[model samples]
Target: MVRWQVNLTVLWLGQFLVMGGMTMIVPFLPLYLQELGMKDPHEVATWAGLIFAGNFVTSFLFQPIWGGLADRYGRKVMLLRSGFGMAIVMTLMGFAGNAWQLLILRMVNGTISGYAPAAVALMSTNTPKEKMGFAMGTLQSGAVAGTILGPFIGGLLAEWIGYRYIFYITGILLFAASVLTLLLVKEKFNVKEASAKPKISVIQAFGQLRHVRQLPSLYGVTLLIQFAMLSTMPLMPLFVAELHGQTAGLAFFAGLVGSITGFSNMFASPILGKLSDRIGPERILGICLAGAAVLFIPQAFVHNVWQLFAARFGLGIFMGGLLPTVNALIRKYTPEGMESRSYSFNTSALSLGNMLGPVVGGAISGYFNIREIFILSTILLFINSLWVYKTLLVRKTSIEVNFEDERPR
Candidate 1:
């Protein structure tokens, strides 16, 4: 295979391992807290929430710093740094004596977590521009597939090998991914050229608006896409329970409902990505956003779990198109020499969305019906679609016309 294709394949695997290992322990956090001697159920719940969100909070703050460094040095070194750092932190979590230790370790894990973003930066610079959507989409599929399977595998492994051992296994997997990247992934970063370029301070990294006009808006798009999709996730089990009634198979059905979107997403992302490559990422993004917004409305009205399942499946097909297209556009608009910084800032936006979506969803569910969250997501996504069309598509058309007018004839 050619070099970019090779980079994509290896990085896809690395992303899979990173995301899967990270997510594996998420479902079992409360249980793990209990094992750590937190007997009070309320205490366990609070600790679990703190431990889980701790990672994203630090990750959101630190990603841009890492991105700046990645541009100054190289994305491959940053990838290895996150991979190895996380592996060590995850391994130590297996030995944490108390909830506080675990929480601190989790926060550290988040602080060092940039493997996926670094992978994206490396791939973005290396891949051909025309194939960028496919690269982003295919890479996203790895993470989605990992997210879908990680919880299930973690649940089973928790049952069989126990919870602490799960951490050990996760550490091993992360180490393996880093080793693979160290040996295989080829990044043609020019050391002399990168050293000669002006250093990107954290402020300079985020202060990219002066350089790239579409960047801040694109960051907003990334944040909103993540926020809209994840906002409904926390309420899913309760919603499933309400729909399915108090049945013994309720957990099974809820798991299915939670994961079915990923099934379709894993398949749809690459397909939509290729379509975007042929047509234009801007238009594909708007089409997918509108479609997802419409799908969310039906989900709010679904009377049964099966109907919700179908709605989520359809929503997945559209959701698959959103991020890859956004990444493609980010690449198209980003200044040269700042590719890593741009993608890293986008990662920070994504981390913010991941942190806030559940909190907002929970608050809305508390004040209103769980179904209202879907309506809220629908409205937000629809607004985002309109914004994309006005900012990206219309702007593209005007620029093209202006270019044609200026061309020598």
Candidate 2:
């Protein structure tokens, strides 16, 4: 048990470091593009949206492919590959001469962004069923911590030196993470199974969606939860700018908002996760959904930076529980062999939300006021929370009944 715990801890640490390094680039990317000759606000905004959307588009498209490969080959190998590939791509991004080059590199980075999925697969496979929630929650805390620290540090570096340096530093850190993964992660490859006929086709691989459909309420609730959670994302920078009126360093203010949210996630995620373990993931999830909705509504009204910070911090507390609870609920519904597929599908849903959230936010902000964007987000979240309660919490169907209902009558 101790050995297993140690192994999990190491994997978690590797994930934390990699995520920290990778996300650090996000807050600085727009500023970097501006420095690289695109000075127009509209151009910078468009490029920023493209950069953000591009990552998710590629990630969503390739996640299932990586999952299938992991199932066939091994999870650890995929982890190493993802880390190494991401490191190289991220480094090359630093040398990009134009916005187009940087956009291409971002797409490449997204294509190889399987480290977290791989790590989750590896950890879930090894962890005891009884302690799965606890373990996953603990792992999530580490990643959140990285997100909290990354932006602040990256923003500072970008301000003091240059934005390109942020990418270089992130690349080096990712490379170091890859090295650590290669050295420490151990997988028992199945020689006999490797020689056998392939068990699943790429199309058949997508058949895993059937499993999720069996738990429609769970799946729907999860999707809504993610949609609600991410709806506020694109407007964050704009919101910060409004709060920090006349601020000299807009990049720093953006970083400050990112860091505050991260800090809240860092502190709140584990506690909510542990609470989920104690009280139950479903109840915790429902409560978080409602709480986040309430908190986020107030964000649209904040007049000062400190007020925005407080609202975001409060929202982060409840929002932090969402992913872990969703994971736990999905685990409860999915079978062992299908866990990887289930997680991959969940990730794809998140990617879809990532794609839609920004587009929705950007569109709303483009035509209407940014504050209206938050109001719309609040409405979406409220609807999402109610949907979760009605679909998952209120329904008391067995897995088999749910499955049967989802099939042809």
The candidate that achieves the highest lDDT relative to the unseen native structure:
1
User: What TM-score does each of the candidates earn?
Assistant: 0.98, 0.85
- Cα RMSD of predicted structure 2: 4.6
Q: Which portions of model 1 show Cα errors greater than 4 Å?
A: none
The model with the greatest TM-score is 1
Candidate 2 C-alpha lDDT tens digits along 33-95:
888899999999899889867888898888878877777677888888999898899889889
lDDT of 1 by residue, 1-409 (tens): 9999989998899888888999999789999988888899889988898899999999999988888888889999999999999999999999999999998998999899999889988998999988999999999999998889999999999999999999999999999999999998999899789889877578866776445667777788889878988888888888899999998999999889989989999999999999999999998999999999999999989999889999999999998998888888887888787888888889889999998888888777768786888888898888988888888889999999999999999
Model 2 pairs whose backbones collide: none
